[model samples]
Target: MIQIPSKIQKIIGNEKYIIDNVGMSGSSVYVFEDKVLKIQAAGSESENEYLMMKWLQGKLLIPEVLAYEKDDSKSYLLMSRISGAMACDDYYMKAPELLTDLLAKAIHMLWEVDISDCPSIINLDKKLEMARYNVEHDLVDMENVQPDTFGGDGFKNPKELLEWLIENRPEEDLVLSHGDLCLPNIFFMGKDVSGFIDLGKICIADRYQDIALCYRSLSNNFKGIYGRAACEGLDTDKFFEKLDVKPDWKKIRYYILLDELF
Candidate 1:
């Protein structure tokens, strides 16, 4: 229901343009010349995303916000475009071997970032609660609920799964997480990773929260990307071994399902 404003056209000047919904979220993204304009309907989520971007500017590969405005209709975030490569999808299709290594490196790099200075980011407990609420309120798509291999058949029941996750949430390790580190969110140029995008969920949380998601993605995308042999090659017990702490399998399962809904 949202459209680009006439003033936005004047602000960017007359030029050939392309508008694509670049993310899974309900946000409007407009690409003009060398800039990307992101606007979200008025809400706390939109405001948090804008704040995250403002906090991360120049610190990471995130695009720089040029201007922000809020009127009766919505809030807008204008940023300089990041030019280079497509997301990790092409690599997953053609060169699958690059998938695991690229993801491993990306996750490692994400862990390296210190988010202690960031303000206004949500905590993991709140995020997990939100996920549970979504399930209880029937806001989540039940048809999309797939059984988690790691949790065995116990993952079949959504309520039981949610309860288990809430009861067994992992201790917070307080590392900067991409929050949603799926393959589609990572950009790559050939075999090299360019950067990450869709950073609205960046936060400090248990390291395994991100690790578990990355592990699930790699396992799903490329069978045995971290199998026994691959684990030896990577010099760890695959993804779980690399984790500084063990993840709550139930929480991991719950989060993965929540990701599909998001």
Candidate 2:
């Protein structure tokens, strides 16, 4: 985080373009004619994203970082606009086969990134390290979870869930992973992938970390559980088929459950 000019402060609440899809990052995003600015509280996650984007400059279709600035409390990331629509856009949702194929391609691209000199690595152990802290500090968001993820039908609480994740940790197939690879985080131009946004959680994690999230995102989008009612709720079976990898339901469930902590 560097000392940036105060120019962004003036655009904070301006009407030019305020992206409402900031998700749960506790951040605000503003879009100018040709640039997108993300403002978030200063933290390592935010710092790591700045690093990862620089490192991936030529590796993937990602946003080009024009400027990264920090004040006493917040960090600002200003980058060129990614040219395309989000994977969750209604147009793509209605074309499930194309959507699944594009998502599978995105995963393959991330996995292809060489991890030899990767700057950030949040494999399972590292993730759980942070999970433990979130649990202890009550930082986990209970309200955003699935039904029965806690209490009666599920684990007693976040602590118990964290313990379960630790005790039942699965072997990992380490690869470059988009820690939060949901539909909205991906972008597409026509049938081709344009770029990926939201790099804070990008890391060399278990292959399953991304797979599970992608699956969950597809299901939610199809069922209309999120933005729109699911697109005839595209069958996830097709998604796994596109990867030509057998579904590891056990590990998928494990990783999804594990994400609850973060």
Candidate 3:
């Protein structure tokens, strides 16, 4: 067990803690009664996540950062828990329509946040540079990636995908993006969006950044890919209709493919 620093230990005093092994943030989440303590490697994204959460305190529904500490080997961030269930809960999975509606509103909420004074800006050019670096350094994680992303139907490998993305980059429709907008990272209270979690990637980026990931997540979730309700033929158009934007499949595909590198 990783030792919780004294500051975070103080907040978690005598409170029974539960391990939260959800989401793909690569962090250890210790859930308490009304707080969450996330422990991750020192140089990982947790520090930036703390900064982003603090900066977004009033603009969006996000966890309130209470304490942050970093040592040579690990970083600890303690925050007030938001009241809600994950958007990927079994309840939402059974109702794809309502799920889509809430997710659409969540995307809109991210866009509506003022980026004039935003803390992070992860534009495509910067992302592409990082993609190239990841490829050169063999940093891409092959597991948990879209299976088709590299098989016979898709690109030959990560390098090919990165090259294709660079050549076919789409027009920018910038917004305050929830860098990783998968269902598990979004929360809801009833039918309303409650808060966002795993905000390490939150930044100013293309609007399609959120849309593409959410679309793929919805499609997979409804198809029982996560082993729940296998609702075939999910009419994903309802999502775009709710978003008030015509489906831009090209941009969507580009963004989805671009995400593979990260």
Among the numbered candidates, top TM-score falls to 3
Runs in model 3 lying further than 4 Å from the true structure: 227-229
How should the candidates be ordered by lDDT, best one leading?
2, 3, 1
Alpha-carbon lDDT, every model: 0.64, 0.86, 0.86
Rank candidates by TM-score, best first. Answer: 3, 2, 1
Clashes of each: 0, 6, 0
What does candidate 3's lDDT look like per residue over 139-250, in tens digits?
Answer: 8888868879998898999999998998998878789998889888999999899999988888899999999999999888877786576765457888899998898999
Span of 10 residues, lowest total lDDT, candidate 1: 226-235
Name the 10 consecutive residues with the lowest summed lDDT in model 2. Answer: 9-18
Question: What's the TM for model 1?
Answer: 0.75
Candidate 1 residue lDDT tens string, 98-183 = 55556666677777777768785556678767777776787766544444422565465556656666676555667777877766
Q: Which regions of candidate 1 are displaced past 4 Å?
A: 5-7, 147-158, 222-254, 257-262
Would you give me the overall lDDT of model 1? 0.64
lDDT of 2 by residue, 69-108 (tens): 8878888988888988899998898898899999999999
Q: Is candidate 1 or candidate 2 better by lDDT?
A: 2
**Each candidate: RMSD:** 5.3, 2.9, 1.4
Q: Model 2 residue 99 lDDT?
A: 94
Residue 76 in candidate 2 has what lDDT? 90
lDDT of 2 at 152: 78
Query: TM-scores, in order shown?
Result: 0.75, 0.93, 0.95
